[model samples]
Target: MLRRGMILVFSVLLLLSGSMTVFAAGKTGEGATPSGIPLAGLEAFVDNYVKEYIGQKTVGASVVMVKDGQVVLSKGYGFADVEQQIPVSPDTVMEWGSISKLAVWTSVIQLAEQGKLDLNQDIRSYLPPDFLTRLKYSEPVTMLNLMNHNAGFEEYMFDMAYQSPEEVQSLEAGLRLAQPAQIFRPGEVVAYSNYGNSLAAYIVELISGQPYHDYVQEHIFEPLGMQDSIAYSVVEDRPELLEHKAKGYFFEEEGSFTQGSWNYMSMYPNGGNNGTAEDLAKFAMAFMPAAGEQSPLFEKPETLENMLARSYSTAEGMPGIAHGFWEYPGTLRTLGHGGNTIAFATNLQIVPEDRFAVIIMTNQAGESNIVHGLTKEIVGMRELTETVDLPDTSEVQGEFMAARRPGYGFMKLFPYLTLMKLKPQGENQLQVSLAGMTGSYQQVEPYLYQKVGGDSALDVWPMLYAKMGDGKVEAISVYTSDYLPLPAGRTMPVLIINAVLAVLAVAYFIISPFVLLVQAVLKKRRASRHSVSGAGSRRLVTCLSLTGTGIVANNLILALRMLSNNERAYSEVYPQLVINYVLTGLAVLFVAALLISWTSKRSALTVRDKRAAILPIVMIAVLAGLLVFWQFYS
Candidate 1:
């Protein structure tokens, strides 16, 4: 099934790369050639492209493009409420999602500019003593680490977002509740951290003596005259803006969508901004200005320059992250961010070199062709000349996992299951397969590679490949999740065996009840006496079987929780987590019972009886050990 899925995706990628059209631009527009890559007829191209996806993939979307400090295109597609026949207009407001992180970073820079906060200084210096309670390391985490998203925090999921406005807590309260354990030393890994971003906002609040939301409003939003936009989640107080806000939707089927609840987050600084696409365009434009003009957001051009500078990368010489923005490979360098909420998705990209920008927002959740595919087409990829001396690729071929994954809890082992594999396709080419998607990359230089041809905009290439290590490929960095080498025992064979065992273990218990009933009936019919060994082994087998069955049931529930990702899951996780711990205790009892049964019953059991009982016990024991190793209990 997995192989077929990968093959299907790979085939689609080939088809897309071969037939995809270049998104064009209006020739008469001021910024038409801002990228210096002529997009002849972009307006018509965008219209046709977006028209096809409007009702199918997204109920509504707002798209705006700016060039040479002028609005080249500002258009809305589909219905804000499909049932109401209400068209999405320029005034339609939408959730900005993670693109909201930009305002937080901008605030950080403003503080740095005022000398109220230092980027390199330890963040703990700004916080109240004993504020952080989840550190696994004593290393001082700095503001630079927060901006670079390498603060070593795990991906703590629960309580960060809720569907109810009342569930939203204060920024400080949210940070403390969702605070994740640090599993890596500061600066050692580039795990993207939302808590880190919000923590920076808390520091802003602590220094400015204002709530984080107020600080953004007074300093950033008001300055840009984005009165229609609000930094707060839910925007419960802004009735006017709320009324205009496009209803968020989840695609049900073709030409069908269901309205989803608004995404409310207590740590609103990271991803809870709701605003119009025009307002987001203004924010994107601020990051990139006309050559000699300084942005109104900053006191000086140098501050903006420093903020846009590279802070972290998986490999050196690759364009990775620029403060809060992600760098994309193009003829002209591009920096931007993508965002999502419960029912909306957005993209913001800026070609700083050309003072050109594109902002896309959709009412759809999870996936959007315009937000991802059309935007990628707008900010196109370019080939770079490769002539530098670099290391060989043969030694770097292996499995890797995303750095942005849960470092602790029952979810810790999830990343291992979808390990990314890089196989050598040629001396200078490698095929990457991960999470059911495969793409081919051709090495341009010693350590840099570009995606060959991808059907989807979500393909892993045109990446500024950062091979970050002394002489070996330690980790390869992408825009978002950098890939780290898989640890020992997480190879494909081991994972396949583990999956097979999980399935067989579930199967054993599933069929055992009927098998036992049939055996009892047959014995009664024959009036046969139970074997002495079988009777002695029954208790131990029952204990082991109960433990194994309980573990399977617990995992099944957790898997369902993952699939039904909604507001209630946050409250449900703790109860499920406690069950995981109880199952571990039962597993311990199984081991003890097996030890006693094997030693005490050895003399009485016949070879067939011993073989039948012992193998399953041993198999259950191995399965339990594997689960423990994967940290499934916590």
Candidate 2:
């Protein structure tokens, strides 16, 4: 009776709290899997680490660790569906996010092995003529450019994903809709491009005379027996798999969580794999070929070896890309990819030399701890060979902006706002801050810095390659993207100045109406002599004030709408752009009127009469200048 009463009390509290959590039962993968590795402690370690974050940071999570061609650990925790009180099991499928790119890369290699695809030849040779409409340079983009993520395409911000599964478009149509301009020349400026990866997938479709998914189903998934996985936006083709899929969630606080919409992508190859933890373990095991055995994913053992070889590096003795896999900091050479969807997160890492691997998946929106933190602990710290005579990091101390950001339009401001600040932490070390994730790095080589410690974001990006120019750092490369020096207009001081000016302008506009009302009432009460300030001046102030307020209102409305939605297709972005253009035109007209008034010099406007008009004019003009400098109008 006591135990039952206690359980009832716990249930009532759970209802009151709203963030339902159950100590979800777990299940092990069924197989005659062997475990010769000294990784027995890993299962307990993962459980302890995961228990801390299950209710606080993530609703449910699945973890699988493998070593020496055997399953070290595979388990699930917490609730897959909190409202339904359904406990997550080993078979509970979750989105694989960018880890889906592994399949695309694998397919690329399979064709290359077959002598059907050229890694060095121009990708344009394979695509239909004029398929690329936004080239800025005449240089050829090769398959390597896509793999290394230096194809120079700008980050396409919208229509790559939709909220509704019904909105899924064909792969070709999705590519056409979100194709970004070639912002940089080919073979330079490494930026993580989703469009580039999907384009590669499309190339697979064109070359094989089959859809990319079908090709994957035959070449990669079927060989590894990853039957529980689907790489498209929705699993309509596999209803049973979809039924087992865990619903994604967004955690607000301790005991508060909201369901998140599934991210339906037409550019699905970039980040759309959904599967069970056990099945992903099977996929991960493909990379670790046992002695006298060949990887089933590749036709030849040499082909798999070549695919894992270093494909790109920003500096010598630094972690880089092995074909499509980003190198991870580990005791040995660890290579794999991490992924994120709207609400699901996953990571797959393998130490090929050690034949060890780890996979973590969670149904948490923009997850951190499990996918990054737990993985880091699993793939222990790499022993540095350059411990003695470490290089100094003085030249790299400054604010920088990531290269993996929209290089066009108003959305460009986002990269600036999340600027990375690197400052001296101690001798031979520097503290790094970007996007609310902070960490410290010690210079192991002249241009290479390894992450000593940080939050999950830094864990996700553990090593950096800094380029020195003259006396300062030119760029800092981290996995798929690089961080370049912040332009003068994008510096923190300049942004603060812009913000202070905008606040003053909005504050002025907000209060100006009350002032005008008082003046009207007084004028009605008593007809005084002709006012000192000219009607032209009053009209200018009132018009500029109204325009400024309107711009602010429009921005707030758009932001609120976007933030409130679980999915973002950016269908409304075009209309918002039109509104911005109209407001910009009004601003231009105001500038013209003010310029014409000043040039005419028909009246000697003084402080008592003209100062009020000048304040708004100065404020708005400076704000406009800053916006133009930051490419907000583009």
Candidate 3:
């Protein structure tokens, strides 16, 4: 009876605390005619602004405002799925992406605390033997480099070709393929590499003799009581309770949308984890040294300090990166990480000194601006308004001309075709042409333009707003291109190519049976004359055999490319077309080998058959060479 009473009291206290937070948040900006605005008024303004601004963008978002180490305003807005009509709530499980880096980093520090791992020592000491020899650099990379993103490794999963897990040869092989050459030297410049984080996870696995996800779960999640969190790519038996599992979508062709597949199954630690907002709040609470005993993760204050400190700055001239967060230099210090997947974008921030934190998760790609704007407004910073002011046409025109001048303007083709040109469109608008395409821009504000272009008719041409102040305007470039319809004249060539390929395949299939029948008839007639098949039959057999050999060789090459790089390549024309070529080659090779063996003298021609297998032998050698190239060079 006494324990029941205590439980009731505890529940009441929690209820009271939640009510007070809501009340304080609501009353912040109330009843302010003059002098200074009430705190309630400010809070109301922030809430209303987020609803008004972010809501119109069709973004599903959750915001938590904490003050004095207490949640003041925690609310969810919009829908998790617009089509399904599922509303978002605070309990919604959103992908934390790179924010999981913090949890992994914490585990590393814990290992260090236990004297099992050293942050300053060479990481190769902890890694497997095979991985050590595969690295390009002589100097070993350290844990610090991985934590601060100083390890020279390219982002392996950025390409669209590598979006499927099945395309990779194997987890280990994929890691080998993703390894990057040291661009500068270790600790020279901070370059964020998803591949580097993956390697770190591998190292952790090597040291702990456990899977990366399992290690983090045992050390970080379980200790912190983050019950709702799980590593990325994990297939849970019951995923519905996790809630707010927002589906990711990408613009396939400008405005045309397509659902993106779960692309992070091959590597989870880098940017593929999911959790609830409140659970993350609990995770942030672990950073408070005062909550040391209550927190399950870390007991030392130095761990928090080390993780929050600005470890390095990005080489691309961005703000400094902390252990797993970005540091903003100011009196009001902030540390956090921003995550972006196909459909969702999230930001987790903590201002430990102020005992405040913010978690903003959205289901839209461009909702980051809204999240940033709302965060500043809630924190009583300057309001971001849509200001309209025309720039001096002469200045705008001059800047445009400078961008178009020789040595200043350039074009490149490899990944895609791109070209840039600058010319005047109207009195106040300047036109920039790219890839034989044109876009008209009207100056709405200084360094801001409302751009419209000819390409996809349904494409969204939102206003391009530059952050440059009074200095020269930075050149505006679109990250995604608008899809274009080919000219009427170009359709015939495509159709002709398809027709030719189809006819050839049909003819080959149709002629093969006839050839076999003719050979059978001739062989039966010549059975008494010779023990071996007729010359015509042998010629048909050889043709089929050679064709089959060519097909298999081509297919093996294609499959390897797809597995190693998540892409198909046939020379350089269409890298993805080799998948089909490979399939055709394999089919032809099997049939040819069968036909040739059937026609040859089974017992007497073993040596001759061995010699005939030279083509396949060479093909295997080439395949082996390609595999080696993919592992080490590609």
The prediction achieving the highest lDDT against the true structure is 2
> Which candidate tops TM-score?
2
Q: Candidate 2: which pairs clash?
A: 409-634
TM-scores, one per candidate: 0.86, 0.89, 0.56
Error of 3 at 105 (Å): 1.2
The TM-score ranking, best first, is 2, 1, 3
User: What are the lDDT figures for the candidates, one per model?
Assistant: 0.76, 0.78, 0.53
Q: Give the distance in Å from residue 57's predicted Cα in candidate 3 to where it truly belongs.
A: 2.2
- Which 10 residues in a row give candidate 3 its minimum summed lDDT? 406-415
Task: State the lDDT at 474 in candidate 3.
Answer: 38
Clashes of 1: 7
Candidate RMSDs in Å, in order, are 7.2, 4.5, 13.5
User: Which runs in model 2 stand beyond 4 Å of their true positions?
Assistant: 1-37, 488-497, 517-527, 531-540, 559-567, 587-611, 631-634
What TM-score does candidate 3 reach?
0.56
